[model samples]
Target: MADRLLDAMARSASRLYGGEAVSELEHALQCAELARAAGADEELQLACLLHDVGRYAVDPSLVFDTGEPSRAGPHARGHHEVGAELLAPWVPERVAWCVRAHADAKRYLCATEPDYFARLSAASRHTLRLQGGVMTAVEVARLAVHPWLPDALALRRWDDGAKVVGKATRPLSAWAPLIRRCFDR
Candidate 1:
């Protein structure tokens, strides 16, 4: 079962990364690795690894494990809505919603909850437009239906944690045991 999950993830990562950057599989795996190191729960760790699984549904190109030269920011801007639509079918609604919204939390939080703007990346100071505009009120309203909003929000926080290069990202293997633990819980 896990093998199938990882395989499906490989496909999503391939297309969503915009013909450049790390394969979507690599990045999603990295996110899951990160969550595992930080002691995140199985579902959340699973969320980290497969957040963008939606990409597979939207674009099969992402399903491949191919590599390409990326122009940097396109991975963030190009994939979110498509990711959301695709994920709605394969995973829980909240996981898909949070994954879709991970890159643009500031805008949604900023408009609805001004305090959130302060939590945005310090580096984002120079790349506002480059990161894509914030999520719209309608989108935010829709995502609210996600059953795992709080968990999704935490996943969003860790998404940022997983970004720094060579930082101590936990390995995906570490979550295997954790995944089992979650079932017993």
Candidate 2:
């Protein structure tokens, strides 16, 4: 399972991340590093590393409406939902929740934090529209009571900060053992 998961991540190593300066793998590594630096547990770190795995794991040919209310889009699942679903059988529920809610975390931040939208990168800004713009008051209320909300928000912070062009990060090899352990768990 770990090997398969790692391979999925490797396939995106050279792929640009939503027009961000960094490649998808780079963003993943950097996000994991940020989690580590913040003293997050292994589960959270792994969640950060594989948060965007859906982009590579799911069929790219699948098309969907980005503005759909269900967050499922029209014909396909959103990447966050896909990633969480893919990880659900391997990792803990908390990890999968973090993966699933990171986008909602972005939406949460945008709605609750004035000036947050302006700080987003251009690519993130564009994706934000596709991610349902901002949370409605009811949506915010729903997310606020989730037990895992704090971890998801932390993962979101790491995701937002992981887009440096040439930032040094631990290689995928360094994380292979950790990935295996998570899968084994």
**Candidate 2 versus the native: TM-score?**
0.91
Clashing pairs in 2: none
Clashing pairs in 1: 11-62, 11-63, 13-24, 13-25, 14-62, 15-62, 54-87
Tens digits of per-residue lDDT for model 1, 1-185: 44554456545543534333345555666778767777876666766776655444344343321122142233433345556665455555656666766656645555577666676555433333444556677978886776666666777666545444334444455555543443233
lDDT of 2: 0.85
Best by lDDT: 2
Q: Candidates' lDDT values, in order? A: 0.55, 0.85
Point to the candidate with the largest TM-score. Answer: 2
Where model 2 places Cα greater than 4 Å from the true spot, the runs are 63-74
TM-score, structure 1 vs. true: 0.52
Off by over 4 Å in 1: 1-27, 37-39, 54-78, 112-132, 135-147, 173-185
How many clashes (backbone N, Cα, C below 3 Å) per candidate? Answer: 7, 0
What TM-score, computed on C-alpha atoms, does each candidate reach? 0.52, 0.91
The digit string of per-residue lDDT tens for model 2 on 40-71 reads 99999989999988776666534232222344
